[model samples]
Structures are given as C-alpha cells and as structure tokens.
Target: MLQRASNANQYFTHWVTAAPESRELLALCLRKLRGLNKVRIIDASFVWTEPHSKRIKVRVTVQQEAFEGAIIQQSFEVEYVVASQQCPDCAKSYTANVWRASVQVRQKVPHKRTFLYLEQLMLKHSAHKETINIKEVKDGLDFFFAQRNHAEKFVDFLSSVTPVRVKKSQALISMDIHTSTKSYKFTYSCELVPICKDDLVCLPIKLAKQIGSIFPLALCHRIGTSINLLDPNTLQTADLPSNTYWRAPFASLANATELVEFVVLDIEPLGEQSGRFFLAEATVARASDMGVNDNTYFCRTHLGAVLHPGDSVMGYHLTGTNFNDPQFQELENSSTYSSRIPDVLLVKKFYARKKKPKRNWRLKRMAKDEGELLPKKADQDRMDADYEMFLRDVEEDVEMRNTLALYKAENKKEADAMSMTETDLDDDDEVPKISMDELLEDFEDLQVGE
Candidate 1:
C-alpha cells in the first residue's frame, strides 16, 4: 500500500497488493510517521478477509490528531493470494497462506517546558520547610528561563512566581560518537622450527610423508650432528644428553643455521573433500644442539628466536603431542607415509567434507516387495468419524457458522442492489475515462530524459 500527502493534514491512499503482516509495509508506515515529527496518532484499525478467498484484502486506517486541530486520515487496502494443494487420498486441500493484522497509535511531543514544570512541582511537593536562599532561587529562575527565546520576560515571571535553592557541584559532561564504520581487528601468530639432524628429533618416516602430502609447500631442511660442531669454541654443542640420540644423513648447508621461526599469513579452504588450510611465512632464528641419549633425541629450546623479515613458508605442521591413536598408526606405517603425509609445517591445512547423503534404499526395496498400496474406503470412514466428532462437539451450541452464513447471504443480496444503484448513479455523472495504453504513454512522456 502507498499513500501521498495532499496537504499538511490530508493524504490520498493508494491500495496495492500486500500481505497483512508484511514487514516491508510496517516499515514503510513507521518511516512515514517518524518523518512527520508533529503528527500524533489518535486511532487506527485494520480490516482483513477471512479464509477461502483467491486473495485476502487488508485495510488499515490511521488518524493523526496533533496538527492544529486538523486530522490526517489514511486508508490502505491490499490483497494477498494463498497457495494450496490437495491430498491424494482424501481429496482434502490445505493452504499455506496465513496473515495477522495489528494497529497501534503513537505520539511525539516537545518536553522542554514540561521538564521544567516537573522540577518546580518536585520542589513544591517537598515535605521539609527548609528556607530557600534568594540568590539560589534567582540563579535557578535564570537557568530555567535562559532556555526560552523570551528569556528576560520568562526569568522575571519565574522569580515572581516561586522561590528555589541551588547548590554548586562539579559535573562532567561527556559525549560519545558511534560510527557505522567502526570494526574489530584481530591478531594472528604462529611459530616455525627449522629442521636439524643434531636436534635429536627423529620424526617417523610415515609422519614425514604424511606431512609432505598434507603440506606440499613445506621444504624439509636436513642437518647432521656434525653441524653443531661447526663452531668448535662452543663445547656446549657436542655434549649429548643421557636420554636423547641424534639421527644420521643430515644436510651440509651452513645457511640452514640462520632460519627458525614461521608465521601464518592467511588461510583458504579447498573443496569439501580437500579441506581448508593456511599459508604462512617462516625464517630461521637460532641454531643449537639438542640433547641426545643412545637412540632418542630432543631439540633444545631456543630463546628469543625470530624469523627473518619476509620469508613465508606454506605448509602444515603438528605442535604438541596430541595425535589420535589411529592417526598415530598412520604415522608409523611407512606405506601410509608414501601414500598420504600429514603436514607439520607452520602453514596448516584442515579438511572438511560433506557427510554421506541419506539413501532411501530400504524404502525403495520395501515398495518393490509390497507392490502398490492403494487408499481404501477407510479414508472416507475416518472422515465420517471426524465429522461425527465435530458435530458432537458443537451439537449443544447455536450454529454460529450457519447464522453468519445466513446473515452474509441476506447482506450480500442487499449489497448487490446497492452496488447496482451506485453504478447507475456513477453512469449518470459520466466520468471521463482514459485507456490504459494512453495512461502508460502519458507516464512514459513524463519521465525525464536520461
């Protein structure tokens, strides 16, 4: 429904097709009323069609009573069509159309003078007969009247009308600005470790292969136990711990000593089968010997290690010992390592897949075994039983439905004659009619060239 204001206190209503409980229509009405700051609602009502119509009609009327004793009245009528389908067995139909109607009145008024009057009322209503200071009273009067355009006259009148008391105290006036563009910022961080043979960290070959499969972007850097002795002055390099051991076949690159920490840059999701993963940047920060026993070794902790400025490593890596048991088995098997590797690089990938879709195989097999199951007269019997129950429930009361139907039939007959007479009267007046095509042409001509 649409409406246009013809004057300050009048409007022309244009009825359009709409749902009774449409949020869009409600929002439009609210926006119109909000824009008219001085308008005060007096009363409102809605009219709606009952069930069983191709289209339900909604009518609403609202009156604004605050415009210089003027009334701004508006009416809207809208139609909505319902969709329905019939049941195959009983031939009974059900509709999906539903609507609700509600009307409310709202008013807006200026409250500056009312607030001042309320303050005065509070002072007058006080039970204690405390003496009010003349200077304080004068200050109060001045402050109250200073808000109005006729400040001098208002202040004089206030002073003559009442006495008041005032007290001085520091009061902070604060204002906060909330903007739509304000947003939240998030921080992300990650750590990277460069591979070293002396680190006493012998990851399972299967684990290495799984890591490679999952994080193809990761580059493994192999270093031997001899690399720790490169600086002979540091005797701390060769002292192996009692419980850890270093593995063999390490790389000879000294440049490997410089890279250490890795950081995550971004993450992206692959398809449902591949899963989501992260891309990261990493660089070496510190080189140190890990303590080793006879067969096992542990990498030493490097303090204050920092990745080089801009080298980004992309791959997934595991941190902390929390692999699932079955996953642990996968890590142990060399064949599995050759097949699919888990990523243990700084860049990580997490895969997600759709669950298996439900299949109606059981139902299909049952149907095939049973052949066709046709609806019997049992449905009619059930309907008869339902009708009997409905009658039993209403047998003792007056038939309101029947009474309404009779009344509507009589009223409809009268309405038909009245409508015919109204049509005759309209025919006598001979209103000028424009063809729809002509109206469309006129509307098109009115459009500005663009």
Candidate 2:
C-alpha cells in the first residue's frame, strides 16, 4: 500500500503490487447475494481501481417494500478465501520419471574439477532456477526441466563455456485421439571435451606437421570453450576449437599427477623477455638420487623472466611407462605406436614457493557453497528484504499494470467524452470565442478532462 495521498477525499490512491481484479472479487459478492434468492438485483456497481477504496465496494439494489416499488441500496465489501491448489507443473515437480525434458551433462575427462567449477558458475548465473531437479551422476550431473525449451537454454549455456557436442532425441509419451494432439519427452546429451588444464596429450603425427611442430607433444594449458595447448620445448601455443578438433582427435597421454619436480640448474633467454617463452636446463629429482648424476632435462616456461637458477618447477616429463615399456613390446618391429614424443612439457610456474602445486588443474575452489556466500548476519538481512528470492513468476498472475493503466486512461477518456455536456449556445462560436471568461472556461474544461 502506498503512503497517504494528498487530498485523499478527491483522489483516493494506493500503490499495490497485485490484487484480485474487479471481476473475480465481484463474483464472490454476487454469489453471496444470490445465496439469498429472495432479493432481486436491479442495479449493481463495483468500484475497485484508481480512486480506489480500501475495500472493494459493491452496491446491490434491494426493494424495501415489495410490490410498492420503493427501493433501498445496500453496500458491502467483496470477500473470498485464498486457496492453494497444485498446478499441473507443480504436481509433476515432486514425482520421479515425470520430466518433460532432461539434460545429461558429462565430460570425457576423469577429473571432476571442471564439473565442480561449473556448479559454482551455474549458481552465480542462476541457470538452474527453472530446472525441476538436479541429479549427481558418476561422470557428471543431470538436469530435469518441465519444458524442452528450458533444457535447450541450459545446453546453450554449457556450449558457450565449454567445447561440447550436443545430441537431441525425443520419446513419445502419449497421443490423444480425440484432440489429435501428441506429447513427447525430450532428452539432450551434451558431451564436454575431455581435455582440461594440465592434462598431457599426444598430438597426431599429421596434426604435428600441420601445426609446424616437429615434436608430437603438448600440455593442456587452459580450457575455455576450447582447449589451449602449450609446447614445452618451443613455448608455442595451439588452440583446439570445437569445429576442427573432431578431424584430428588427440589421444590423452597422461594427467597432472604424473608430473615430477625438476630443480632448475641453468637458465637462458629464448629470444626476448617480452617473447613467448624462456629456456632452461633442469635436472629431474629422482625418487632416489644415484651415485652418478643423470636425468638432466631441457625444460621451458612462460614465466622464465621471473625465474632464477635455484627456483624449482613442477611439470610433466615423458618417461617410460608400462604401455611403452621395452619389456612389454618388441622394439624391433616398430609397427603401430612406434614414434614416441619428446621428454618434457611445461604447465605452470610457481609464483609462491611454498604452495607450489605438484599438478595443474582447471577451476578454482569455492569458499562456501549454498544459497549465499556472505556471513550469517548479513545474509539473513538480505534474505528478509528480498521479496522475490524464493518466488517463481507465475505467468498468468503477472500484473499487466502497464496495459491496465493504458486501459484505464482510454476508459477515462471515453467516460469524459460521454459526460461532456453539449455547448449551451447554438454554436461553439456563439459562446464568445476569446474573451477572458472564455479562456477561464477553457482552463476549466482542461481540468475536467484531466
């Protein structure tokens, strides 16, 4: 309700977010009056808008002395009970296997870090507000919605953030014979690209030639709708976009945990401090150092300008594994997976010495996860003040105040036109065209129209 308007007797006014319209409220009053069937209604009026009353005014004509024709009028407020009934969509929200559309979101990579980060991102964006329910699966998450268009919107959001391939399918739920209408349940499968930050991948030999790289190795640097790869030897960058990656699919070589720490032994400028990379000579710290020194490796970093000889760095090194072990395969026949990649690939440099990560992983950690991240005191105050925090906009109940105002304006104009009395004289000219009194009369006319 609005603050008291000035001159309340002349222009009754109130500010309301929503209220029952004249029809629904008036119906309740009519029903009550009809309950007393003895009364015959001659005239009834309902007033409940601008120049509005605190209560909905309803006047019904009642005959005081029957058959004598003397009548009296009685006025009362319209009233109705506010009842709650489960809507069609709300009824289905609590049941299982009742989804009109579902989205299965999964990533090819084994790590769950990307999915974890995605959860926070969606929370901030309010993406799941329209979703019926969310389920956590082994590979990723599943989203359920009441409409297929809602699922499509979520899929588009995912595609914007990650390189994903989408497949859509629908199953027929039922076909109405009389109405000749059919209903279907849709399913959207979104496959996120397996590559993530710090994962090692083996470039195809053909792709290596195409990328102008002699070594068939690259380390995943960053992932943002596309995979960013960095060459440890040359510090060269390559992008794997959603459009072209399908043609030359790279094989997953290893993860970030497979990396070993290397002590920086020597440093050299690649080209310039402002260039792409810096070169360095480093010795890999073995599990147990042998009596004789070995395992000295040539490594590269993007932050070589800030690095010194003694600074330690963590990166992936291509050492012998069971898959490529000599004992597992006869080296003589170099048939299929013969040509192996080079020694090392750089991922990141440790700006802070103590918290140096042994492996590189995409996505940052959240401080707290829930509805809000603020402290309890401040969060509670915000929750109390927010009128629409937990409320969903009901399409039918949305107040079309703009349209209502326009209608009221037009209706008032028509009312004024009809209320207008004809000129008292024969013609408008006979009314004294431009006298001082005529001018004052014109101002009065404007005030009445207003």
Clashes of 1: 31
Spell out the clash pairs found in candidate 2.
none
- For residues 408-441, what per-residue lDDT tens digits would candidate 2 score against the true structure? 1121212222112122223323111112221112
Deviating ranges (above 4 Å) for candidate 2: 1-97, 211-215, 273-284, 287-294, 322-341, 350-450
Angstrom error of the Cα, residue 113, model 1: value is 81
What global local distance difference test value does model 1 have?
Answer: 0.26
lDDT of candidate 2 at residue 300, scale 0 to 100: 56
Worst 10 residues of 2 by lDDT: 387-396
Scored by CA lDDT, what does every candidate get? 0.26, 0.52
Q: What TM-score number comes out for model 1? A: 0.15
Model 1, 225-245: lDDT tens digits are 212221101111221111121
